[model samples]
Target: MPLVRVDAVAADPQQLDAIGDAVHAALVDGFGIPADDRFQVLRGAAGDRVVYDPGFRGVDRDDGAVFVQVFLRRGRTDEQKRAFYRALAKHAGLAGIEPRNLVVALTENGLADWSFGNGEAQYLDDPPS
Candidate 1:
C-alpha cells in the first residue's frame, strides 16, 4: 500500500479529490498497486504557507504549486519508477495541476515498515499476494 500526501495552495474540495483520484490511478496503472488500496492525506494550505522556488531546477513554478509525496514498499524496477513518474505527472496535469508546479517525491521502505492498524506491522505478519 502507498500512503500519499498532497499539499496544495488554496485548492478546493473538488480539486483535492481530483488530484487524489489521479494519484491513485497512477499508482494502480504504473506501480501495479491494487485499485482499492487507497490511503491519502490531502491538505490545502494558505498561499503564504505554501512556498516554492519559482525557478527551481529551471522549472517555473507559481503560487499554485502542489507537492505530492508517496511512501511505499521498495521493490519496483528503475523502469517502473520512471513510468510511474510520467504517469503521475500526466494524471495530475489532467486534474488541472500544472506540470511545472507539480512536485512529486517517493519514499520506499520494506515490509517491516508498515502498520495498518492494531499497532502491528500487517505487511510483515501477513504479506499480500
Candidate 2:
C-alpha cells in the first residue's frame, strides 16, 4: 500500500478527491500497484502555511501550488518513476492545476516497515503477488 499526503491551499473536497484518484491511477499504472490498494491524507492549509518556490527549477508556478507525497515500498526503476510523474501531472492538469504548480514526491521504505493492523506485518507475511 502507498500512503499519499496532499498539501494545498484551501482545496475543495471534490477536487482533492479527483486529484487523489489521478494520483492513484498513476501509481497503479506506473508502479504496478494494485488498484484496490489506496490510502491518502489531504490537507488544505490555512493562510500562508503552504510555502513553495514559485519559480524554482525554472517552473513558473503561483500561490495555488500543490504538493503531493507518496510513501511506499522501494523498488521501482527510474523509468517507472518518470512515468508516474508524467501521469500525475496529466491528472492534476485536468483539475485546472498547472503542471508547474504541482510537486510530486515519492518516499520508499522496506517491506518490514509496514504494519497493516492486528499487530501483524501482513506485507512481510505475504508479499505482493
Note the Cα lDDT for every prediction shown.
Answer: 0.87, 0.84
Q: How do all models score by TM-score?
A: 0.93, 0.92
Clashes of each: 0, 0
- Clash pairs for candidate 1: none
lDDT of model 1 at position 22: 87
- List residue ranges in candidate 2 displaced over 4 A: none
Q: Write the per-residue lDDT of candidate 2 for residues 93-115, one digit (tens) a residue.
A: 88777778888889999888999
TM-score of 2: 0.92
Highest lDDT against the true fold, candidate? 1
